[model samples]
Target: MLSPRAGAPPPSCPRAHSTYALAQLHAALAKSGLSTGSATPATAAAAARACARLGHLRAGRAVHGASAKLALLPASALLPNALLHMYASCPGDHYHLQLARLLFDTMPARDAASYNILLTALAVGGHVDEALELFEDMEDAGMAPNEVTVVAVLAACADVGDMDLGRKVHSYAKRQGYCGNVLVCNAAIDMYVKCGCVDAARAVFDGMGDRTTVVTRSSMICGHAMHGEGDKALELFAAMRRQGVRPNGVTFVGLLHACSHMGLVDEGRAFFESMEKDHGIAPAIEHYGCMVDLLSRAGRLHEALEFINGMPMEPNSIVWGALLGGARLHRNVEVGEEAIQRLAVLDPGNDGYYVVLSNIYADAGRWEDVARVRRGMKLRGVKKTRGWSTVSVDGTVHEFTAGDCAHPQATAICDTLDGLLDEARRRGYVPDTSVVLLDMDDAEKERVLARHSEKLAVAFGLMTTPPGTTLRVMKNLRVCRDCHAVMKLISEIAGREIVVRDRNRFHCFKNGVCSCRDYW
Candidate 1:
């Protein structure tokens, strides 16, 4: 809650003493006779800046308590702003924003810099709603926002996925001539992309002038690649290079992602090699994961395994997970065994990967191995996440979890789901019982799979939306194999395009084919 003031006073900055404050905090803290009473605002500000930069919360709080005891913050805007920033930059697990907000509320008078620092802290510190609330309060206090303010507010909007408000902020920036600011423009593009409107991001990117930098190129490329627009991402890369801008590691990460999504295995490898050879960028683990995923999804499991073994660094869980996923798809037991063995050593007791391995075993008719996996899970006390789906209708999201028939329309939704399942079975749609990993026949597993969250959500979608409407679903977990098989049939039977966005990526089921080509 912000209290309004008629106006705020000017900033009272202390003498700039420590330009090298961050690199020298340890030295200062190790000095003799640095008592709190004798400490000036400059010394405290520099120390707090060091603590904030280095993420030293306990030391920072020690300084904060001293400032409060010395009664220095109420007299100077600069000291209070430093404290506000210090608290805000404290780790989120510590809930630092609460203290930041307290400092903000008790400030004697807040200038634009005070508000700006607090705004940025809240936004980056995971207090998105509070940041927006403070922004509104700043405007209500008759303070016109500068570019910094708009960018911070826009980031908060993006974090909360408020595209409507983000657009309004963009409009305000344009009206204030702050849209031309390169950093602001980049934030706007990032905001749109994060809000699931790559088109809007493209609009912002195309509207930019000569101030675009490498960051701008990476953002645009990532936006296009994220939306399954591989060609567009590559085109942007070419344009970026044509303008004499060197691509960084992130640019190739996006490029590799685009190639992986589109199944351009050759191009993916080429871009990967080009990154190190031409761009002088060594591959990070994420880039290696992309290449592994690229090879695995294209049914090159042997080559993918070789690539993993030949890596310069030890493969992490993500890299092994890619191979495990490919093994699941191809039911190559040997590769799955190798990847799982490595993953078990690296990231032991990870339930998701273990489940995938169990599913692979069941698919290959290795019931003994599946039983061993179940025993391992029981020993490790790891349980699979219950799948959940969220369907938004009329601006309200209705959530349903597997085996949770708790909603008002649960009975009707289940009944409709039953009908759909019966029709699909009659049309030769077999259930993927391998995904269940239960000690039962396919028929028994089919009964269990019917109750997965996505089915109930699809049934609800059919009941609520009119005929021929595209049903969009967002699932909290990965879409299981049975649910995916059912979704493919539902799209054909219902004569509607169904889009299900899961944890990994989007699955657009149209005319019996998923956009991912069933790789995921």
Candidate 2:
């Protein structure tokens, strides 16, 4: 019998013809073996997009392997761009930058989207310099930077306080009409704010032709609050609300932080409640932190502890730290002990908790307990972190460690510290030596308490900064009670504002009054 023609189908319904065609196509692909091995560029691109959508790394890698086998993956600009996005969106994957960089270097045709992706990855990854470098490279390559590029570059500038670079980027953005983009404008505003250039930040905020987003408003509020401008922050918040922009979680965080900084306990509480009531925003852990800070500042230690215990979610180290701090502020040894215990269990390897516990015990005159805790610490091999401070003066950043005598101005710093102590004593600054937990004589304890990092930073601030200018110091640890008292005296006697940013919160001293109200 004569064989049927190649295109002819078996004696079946006409609808079966389509299925026959599909089978032939599959057979052809299987004969080529390309489908089973490496994926073609078209297939890789599609797979990359699908992997990104599903967030399936294993499948993505398999597709990538297939592409590599065919040499059809990431060889083209569009395909690599898609792959770059896939890598960038993977959480905790820092190698995205390397991939992005490689793809960016090898791409024969670069687009604004690719450049923006790489720049954003760099900025968010804390590689500000690399972001700037990429921006410069993009400009050199004659690729007109788009709105996304402007925002990414501005964010990088903001992170490092590169005002010169920021100004350049701002000018470029304004020229490119990117200044109208809310995201670009917000990044500009945030950059200025974080760079300690509040005036610049305000200028950008005011010049915004469009309405600000909640994130932009929150950034402005937080910038003002952090720089000791609570009233300004509140004003911005009010303006944001009046403009019909709903405040988000970050907005509430900024508002509550502003109130906490200014010791506005009632206002802070109202904002905290309104987060859920008026704004319909659930309070996050940071919000709870703000509340704990507020109550602690107000000397409502019992209330703060209760609030922490009543949290809807499991408390983290931050909450426990705040609770421990509040206990120390109120001298509630029992609460402090409880917080310390919980903290130890929560973070077994953290040495700060142990040190704070010892300090609390020492503050409460529980010498035996302090000794026992110290013994336990030694047995567990828990070593306390050494305190350090960084002071920037005259374009030089000076670092000091606890009991450090390595600075070129060490002698002057020590003498100035002695003078400050004498002046403080004259002004009724009694040293609370109880913070030193070592089993030593009273004189030795006094000496140990005298050399705390906060004291060192304050002394350096007094000796260096102008007579009436505010002293801004940052410490890596909490300020001891004795040092806190001395700072209050120094602020009054020297007739200057003293701002200390410790590990916990900002402590402002003016005229013998700390912004914490002796609560923290």
Output the number of the lDDT-best candidate.
1
Indicate which candidate wins on TM-score: 1
User: Model 1 scores what on Cα lDDT?
Assistant: 0.79
Candidate 1 stretches with Cα past 4 Å from truth are 1-80, 91-95, 104-119, 126-177, 209-211, 391-398, 412-430, 441-444, 455-472, 485-499, 509-513
Query: 352-467 in candidate 1: lDDT tens per residue?
Result: 88888888888888889998997898888888767788775654567899877799998999999999988988888888777877788777888889999888888899999889
Prediction 2 global C-alpha lDDT: 0.73
The number of clashing residue pairs in each candidate reads 0, 1
TM per candidate comes to 0.76, 0.68
Tens-digit lDDT string for candidate 2 (390-439): 65555445678877788888888888888888878887777676777777
Candidate 2 Cα deviation (angstroms), residue 36:
12
**Model 2 lDDT-worst window of ten:** 8-17
> What local lDDT does model 2 show for residue 394?
55
lDDT of each: 0.79, 0.73
